[model samples]
Target chain A: MSINKDTVKYTAALGRIELSEKEIEHFTGQLDKILDYVHKLKKVDVSKLAPTSHVLEMKNVYRDDKVKPSLPVDEVMKNAPARERNLFKVGKIIE
Target chain B: MELNRLSAHELMGLLDKGDISHVDICNSIIDSIDKKDKSLNAIVNFDKGKVLERANAQKGLPVFIKDNICVKDELTTCSSNILKGFRPPYNATVIEKLLNRNAILMGKTNMDEFAFGSSTETSCYGTTKNPWDLERIPGGSSGGSAACVAADEAIWALGSDTGGSVRQPAGLCGVVGLKPTYGRVSRYGLIAFASSLDQIGTLTKDTEDAAILLKIISGHDPMDSTSVDRPVPDYAKLIKKDIKGLKLGIPKEYFIEGMDKEVKQSVLDAIKKLESLGAACENISLPHTEYAVAVYYLVATAEASSNLARFDGVQYGLRSSQAKGVIDMHKKTRGEGFGDEAKRRIILGAFALSSGYYDAYYLRALKVRTLIKKDFEDAFKKYDAIITPTSPTPAFKIGEKTEDPLTMYLCDIFTISANLAGIPGVSMPCGFTKSNLPVGLQILGKAFDEETILRIAYNYEQGTEWSKRKPGI
Candidate 1:
């Protein structure tokens, strides 16, 4: 349950955030505390219990497949902070 | 017309009586924002011209929506930089419902980016201050909506509750917040958090106002696959104050080791007040209560990781330009667009869902989630409603727990069970801590029994003066 500084940094990197050293230390302590508390779950006897994902018993409620008109592309792109050639422009993904 | 100070119910009454035009109300609200929002920064965007035009053509009541909900032609950032300038092509089902009812769109309120934080400070625009004490947080994700209602910036506002976002903040700001049963309201327009747990609810100054807004927004939405097909009940017609012979359960597990004494005492006092109103209170045990936070973090984060994957800046939201190709764009944009909290959750969720850990983490948590739901079901068989402190402590000061995620998660201990069980719960102003910060009492009802909880809250609110204790703004 102990979260070391290195692990914290790794996790932060995966989350795409750069944490300051101070934040790393603080989060380490905090995450350790939370993990300790939640560790109690290991003791519960749920051998026969079915894992419940949705509380409602119903299933497969879906909208019908149909062609629907969309707002004009110009109106949709009006709010884009960056755009080009009628497409949403962004930073190139590949190196 | 002091549009900023009127509740939605009051505004609706005025609109019905033809005392003021919807345009007048929208104009007054916009003016109020211009006058007050300098210090508050509660509203993210204001479409005054469009709002007025819409108002002039219809009823004059003003409505503030959480920034996460989609509205055509308006930015739906969810307060994250990733969606900094994204606008939806269509209105969310709720927006369509409001427009059909002729409610005027006031503006979009700020929230934690991606609805990820307990405090509104995580919002891209800035933190929404508690109206009572400006330095403290307005309990968040729904912080802006709660603050706007408390400060009377908008008549009534809508907020989404995934875990305790709406109820916790509403309690802190001293207002009425109702998180209806999971399927009671459609989530089609809501930016998804934990899809299973998220429900759109109302934040208002009074239970009756909550009732009215709920009635208008609650219904079957063909657009939201998760929305229930059940008939919308006549909520406004059933505001009863009589709690006579009603069975109330006080869970033993909620009063845990770290709970604030003042909050515990205030809740106990509220229970006594309810008893005085002819309700019988008895002790009950939801033994699985201790596992709620763990289960919530696991399930919510897992869903969040998936839901947020769409925000990689390709089709919508903020795009990072430094990368060379599509894959880089996804990573770079997500990296730059998401806040620290949102990132932490996404990473944590991804880790939980990873191949080697799925069973031990996600699957195990799901099993415990069921145990938690069973606890509520078993207890509700014996009791009509369960009462608990909405939060273990009053609203903490801004930055108090920002670096400490555990403390922030602990703040939701009392409110997470209802989300897990997919039941209706309401938080109402009950009392205040010595710091003069407000505390809330939670009334949790059986699945889909929102009316019962609201009736109890309405009755308690009428008999007590706690709701009137506004923070010294």
Candidate 2:
């Protein structure tokens, strides 16, 4: 149940966050505590139980697939930190 | 009139009678915000000209919306740096309803970044101090909404409740906060947290105000697939004071060892008052109550991990200047946009939902969630409503539990069960702790039966003096 420093670093990388060494140490302890507490779930006899993802029983309630008016491209792009020619500008995707 | 003190219903009445113009209400609110918000930090954004224009032709009442909800041209940050300047082009269904009713949009209230924390302390703008005590934390991620109402900054405010974000802070700050059934209010404009558990609700000064606000906003919306199609009830007509034959269940599980003794006594006294008013009280067992905190973190964080993934820099929000490519842009933007608690939850949630760990964490927590819901259903079948202390204690000092995630998660134990069951619940002031902090009593009812819960809360509030006590702030 112990999460080593390397695992913590890997997880933080996957989550796109940079953690300080102190934070990694602190999180390792905190995550261990949480995982230890959640370990109690393993004792429960849920073999016959179905995993319930949503409390409500309804599913697939969808709207009609119809085109509707959308905001003007200029209005949508008004808040973008960087943009060019009506497109949101981001760093190039591939080298 | 000082805009802060009037309840939404009172303001609406004044507007309907032409006694106060919408322009006047909007101006008064803006003036009040300019004067009082320096210390409270409750409001994150204000659009005075637009608000005045929207208020000019119709009624004279102003409304506050949580920052997470989209309001056409207004900023919708969810109090996170990631979407710092983002303005959603479309109005959410709830906003549409409010505009249709001639309610003026005053501004957006602050919250925990991405609605990730219980205390508003985690907000990117800064913490919203509890109006009652300057140094204490306001209950959050709807802390600003609750604090604003408590301070009379706005007549009424809209807040999203995902794991008691609205109700818990309302309890701590001494305001009326309701977490409607999951689909009771439309989610079309609410920034998603845990989607299945998120619902837009109201935080106001009294039950009557909450009733009127709920009436205006509750209904089906074609844009939100999960919005329930149930007929909206006449909430005002259902506000009867009759609790004579009602059965109220006191969940034995909620009175845990670490609970503040004053809060426990306050809850007991509230129950006694309910008894004197002719309601019967009984001790009930929700055996799975002990597992609520663990179950909540697992499910809420798992969903949050997925919902927040959509915030990568390319879509909308603050993008990092250090990016050399799209992947770098996504990584740097997320790293810089999210606050610490949000990053922690996303990482923890990602771990929980990972391929190898799904069965032990996500799936198992789902089974436990069912048991928690079953406990409430079984109790409701035997009683009319369930009562518990909204929080184990009242408002803590701003930095008290920031370092301890488990302790912070435990703060929502009593409130999370109702969310797990998709039931309606409310938190109202019952008494004050020895330190003068407010304690709240939670009244939980069956799904879609908000009237019963509100009735019980209103009756209790009427019989007590706690709701009348305000923070000197």
Candidate 3:
């Protein structure tokens, strides 16, 4: 139930959040405390139960595959920090 | 007359009679916000011209949309630094509904960063202080919305409840907040916190206003596959003015140890008042209640971690320009954009969902969630509604539970079960403490049975003096 530094770093990396030494320490403490509390769920017998991911009993909600008007390209790019023509610009991923 | 202080229902009457112009109401609100907001810190953004223009176009209540709900072309920051400059291209389905009805958008109110905390203190904009007592917090992540309604800064407001985000704040601020059935309201445009548990609800001055707003927003939406296919009822008209012979259950587990004595007394007195008004009160059991918070953290944070992953630097929010590579950009942007609580939750979620821990943590919690939902289901079979204290205590001091996140998490223990059960729930002012802080009584109903709870709440609200006491902010 304890959250160690390695777990914090690994999870931070998984979530793409770069944590500093202090935050790692802070989060390790906080997460460990939280995990310890959540660890109590182990006592409850869930052997005969099914997992409920959503309350609504729904399957794929189909819509007509027809063309529709979307935001103008300019509007689409309005909040993009970096853009080139009609595409979002990102740090170089390829040479 | 103090038009700013009137409820939406009352205000609408004046508007219908041409006794008050939309411009008049809008200017009164603008003036009130200008004068009172400096002390309350409830409103994060406001522009008179924009509000007036929207007001004049469609004559509806001046409503505040929680900062998390997108309003199309308006800044839709979930009150986070990462989304600091973001304005959504399309309105959330709820916002679009409001617009069609001519609901005036006052401005996006502040909230906990990504709806992670119970108190508004977690908001990056700064803590939104409770209007009743300036040093205490207005409960959050819908703190701004509830506080505004309590302060009469807005006639009604829309807030998204993941786990008591709307109700807890509403309870603390002496207003009314409702979390509709999980699929009763569309979540299409609401910024997600916990997808399964998330619901868009209302914060209003009274239960009637809650009924009015709830009716407008409830119904199926193609954009939100989870929205139920049931027909929306006229909740305002459906509310029974009398609760004679109505069966209300008082779950003994809700009045747990460490609950503030005054809050417990207020809830009991309210129960007595309901009984005196001819409603039958019976003690009920919800055995799985203790494990709710533990299950909630696992289920909610897991969904949150996945939902928030979309905020990676590339799409529409802040991008760390100093990074040399794409991955580095994402890491830096998220690290910088998110606040402490957000980082804590994402890491916790990522840990829970990570390999080796997924089965024991996330899956088990889901099964336990089924147990919690069943508890409510069983209770509903026997009782018309369940009642409890909305929060264990009234509004607490700003820094009261910040140092210990678990203590802060427990503030929502009583309210989280309603979300897990997918039942509709509401928190309305029941009484005030000796120190003048407000206490709330929670009324929970069966899934999609908001009408019954609204009726019970309306009858109780009509008989009580609590809802009539406005904070002299």
Candidate 4:
């Protein structure tokens, strides 16, 4: 499918990334080229096929409900940009 | 003999025999890096005092690891700017395993940002040059690991392969790199690129070093749900057996017309050598081979888009002071934090998985992935292993394919199929191009059948001088 500046804006939004006008123009061209290439897969007849999400058989992995020690608060908060009284502080989630 | 020049296993032997102390080995390696790394940039960060302290233990053996794998209190950046200055509080399972073995955690090596590129050029820290020729690109995102091993900067290194990140670089740098079966090595601490396709592997000076390192690191971990529960075999012992009469499949599609003439000839010569050594080579077909790269980008980028969401400037990594709201914070942080290639992947992945296009792109790619795996299964019914060129060509000059995203993606052509099939594969030095660039002969095996692949690589390595010649850098 053909991609444009609008496509880059939408993708950047969905990806939680902000881009400048220049990046949008640049990605508009790059994404258009890549999508065209990846579209090559459309020709394969997969009508009777089932999608393989993972290479291995994955099942619900269960473990005994036990308390495992967690990383100490000091170390856990080591990289937090904003924090307070043993909690990570962030911009307000609610309006 | 140069102390840094010895393989990991050789160092182990010397340590056992009391011929040298770990301190002496550690110093030799540290000095080699001090001398060589300024030009090579194989290692990104290291503190000699801490590394030397760790090396003082009787069993302490220095290992330079890819920056993507967590080593407690060390920066596990995946060579991305987002993770700049961020050190993990805990060790990945493999790191713990190595620490227990007294593996000296020397330092972290460089890689493509978030393991996104075939060449090390995408690293925020800068490209790691090939040891053989300083001007040529080192095949990556495991470039740093392979280059360091080739230059003898460290005994060996661990590199995670999603799409030939391990094997391709191993081939170009003239080192031994093994992309073990998907679940053989736990991914607990490996920062994800493509979860299902990603595997932590070994890069070393030779095939035996790969085997020994694999033995020390391979096993199940309750921490990693995807880790296989099967008993770990004695890989060191398994590679000792003769490879005579073993059947090897040569997929005709891999030697595509117009591929680099020199690279194709190198692999063809390798096939002849294996035949002379009594290993049977047969022509085989994996009909869906061409679609592997297309399928891999869909699956890998989609997984990467999801995995990298954790870096949203919420808890760790770079945050934006410009953000006025929580959503703005995430957007600005990722925008500023990630490199260009990473942003491109996130955008493509987000587009592929978007509501309207999911089935046409992501879903169809998954089905094609199944077909690719089926090819291996069908071939293995007759052949014991498969062989091909690890990369279509030897190391290209730095920035050669960076301008075109599609061209860069093509670098992983022969290697991506193994990851899609969840099989074990390795690239060993087969021969050199007339221009002196190293070419890798890839050997692939069925899931959890690394022993066979390792055996073929070992047999080929022992019989050839390709892996023996050191990079003159």
Candidate 1 vs 3: which has more lDDT: 3
Judged by whole-model lDDT over C-alpha atoms, candidate 3 comes out at: 0.91
The fraction of reference interface contacts (C-alpha pairs within 8 A across chains A and B) present in each candidate is 0.55, 0.60, 0.87, 0.77
Residue B382 lDDT, candidate 4, scale 0-100: 93
lDDT tens digits, residues B303-398, model 1?
998888777666776667776666655666776788778877886786677676688778889999999998999999999999999888888888
Q: Which model, 2 or 4, shows the larger lDDT?
A: 4
- RMSD (Cα, Å) for all candidates, in order, is 2.7, 1.8, 1.1, 1.0
Q: Where does candidate 2 stray beyond 4 Å?
A: A18-22, A84-86, B1-3, B16-18
TM-scores of the candidates are 0.93, 0.96, 0.99, 0.99
Clashing pairs in 2: B4-B152, B22-B60
- lDDT tens readout by residue for model 2, B378-465: 9989999999999998999999999898888888888888887789999999999878888888999999999999988888877888
Best by DockQ, which number?
3
**How much is B95 displaced in model 1, in angstroms?**
0.6
lDDT scores for all predictions? 0.84, 0.86, 0.91, 0.91
Best by lDDT: 3
Per-prediction backbone clash count: 11, 2, 0, 0
Q: Give the C-alpha miss distance for residue B139 in model 4, angstroms.
A: 0.7
Ranking by DockQ: 3, 4, 2, 1
CAPRI tier of model 3: high
Any runs in candidate 3 off by more than 4 Å, and if so which? Answer: none
lDDT measured at residue A26 in model 1 versus the true structure, 0 to 100: 68
Report the poorest 10 consecutive residues by lDDT, candidate 3 chain B. B52-61
